[model samples]
Target: MKRLAVSLTLFLVLSLGVGLLVSGSEVLDWGIAGGLFAIAVLGECFRFWIRRTRSKKRDSSSV
Candidate 1:
């Protein structure tokens, strides 16, 4: 249940960011929508990677 809530929250935040970018692009350059989405995903992946590594280090240190 806690994991589900976290997943849902991330999904909603990503969707909101992408939706805004796509919608706002209607007035500017629309081609960058895909690029923006890709960049967002890349950033998120990097953040997740950092978090995972930090947690692993912490867990190993405590054991």
Candidate 2:
């Protein structure tokens, strides 16, 4: 439940940021949007890799 709420909040915030970038008519707007997108992607990748490594460790220790 907590994770769901957090995810929703992040989604809304990111959506707003992207919407602003789309509506605004400035180079800086695009830069901000691109930077935010890259940051989010990198964060998700990092979280995935960490979860993968931790699961591997848990599986090995159980044997």
lDDT of 2 by residue, 5-57 (tens): 57656865785578586766754465666667667657766877998999999
State candidate 1's TM-score. 0.51
> CA lDDT, every prediction?
0.64, 0.69
Q: TM-scores across all candidates?
A: 0.51, 0.59
Worst 10 residues of 2 by lDDT: 24-33
The parts of candidate 2 lying over 4 Å away from their true place are 1-28
In model 1, the Cα lDDT at residue 42 comes to 74
RMSD vs true structure, all candidates: 5.2, 4.6
Clashing pairs in 2: none
